[model samples]
Target: MQIRLLDLLSRIKRLQEEREILRRNQALELLKTLKKEYEELVEERKKVSQVFTKSRFFKAVELQDLIRLRDSLLEWEKIAEKKLKDGYEELAKIEEELLERHKERRLFERLKEKEMWKQSEEELKRLYRELDELALLIQGQENKR
Candidate 1:
């Protein structure tokens, strides 16, 4: 039973590591996509600025609308960046928890193994003592004969 527990613990640890690695890979992919988005937003801001200088088509009403739209997009991008950072922190917390669980499982397995060994040893000793007593009784009966 102790050995079985050790095997179960090992399997759980392996699964934890696999989950962590997959999460890290997902984060990397998101980072790449974000980088591309950041570049595109910079280009878009430049284009909007050029509209004010290069064209009379954007007057009071149009200018306000353009500015509002740009601001909203910028806010969305900031939120996305924040989420990316928070995702890393959450993953780190999960890793720490897994480490603690692994440690606990190892300690439990060691204690169980020690208990099993002691029980087997005590049983063997008791059997040996019984055999010795029987041998002594037989020898005494033969001497009387």
Candidate 2:
């Protein structure tokens, strides 16, 4: 029964480790995606700025259009920033969960080790008692002889 429990605990530990690895990979992928999006936003902002600078002789309607474009770009930048923040928050939550699973697995492992040690001690004591009884029996035979 103890051996079975130990085996089960080990399996649980391995599963926890695998889960952590998967979460870490997911976090990395999310970070990569966020970085790509940020880079794209930066590139787009730069293009908008270049256009605004190069078109100095804009008519009234053209100027209004440029203003609207700038406002839209600003709104998109805000949205991107919010998305990045949310992604980081999600990663943090996953890391916390992984840490908790690791702690639980370690606790089970410690309990298994303690149980094994106790069983070993009991077996050792039983063997010592058997050896003592055999020795006494041999001494009695010798005395009789």
**Model 2 lDDT, residue 82, Cα:** 87
lDDT of 1 by residue, 76-132 (tens): 768767766776676677667657665765666676677678878998999999999
What candidate 1 gets wrong by more than 4 Å, as runs, is 1-63
Error in Å for residue 126 of model 2:
0.4
RMSD of each: 5.4, 1.9
**Clashing pairs counted in every model:** 0, 0
Q: What lDDT does each candidate get?
A: 0.73, 0.84
Q: What stretches of model 2 exceed 4 Å from their correct place? A: none
Clashing pairs in 2: none
Q: Write the per-residue lDDT of candidate 2 for residues 11-114, one digit (tens) a residue.
A: 78779877887987888798888878887877887887898888778899988987888788788888888888888888888888788878777878888888
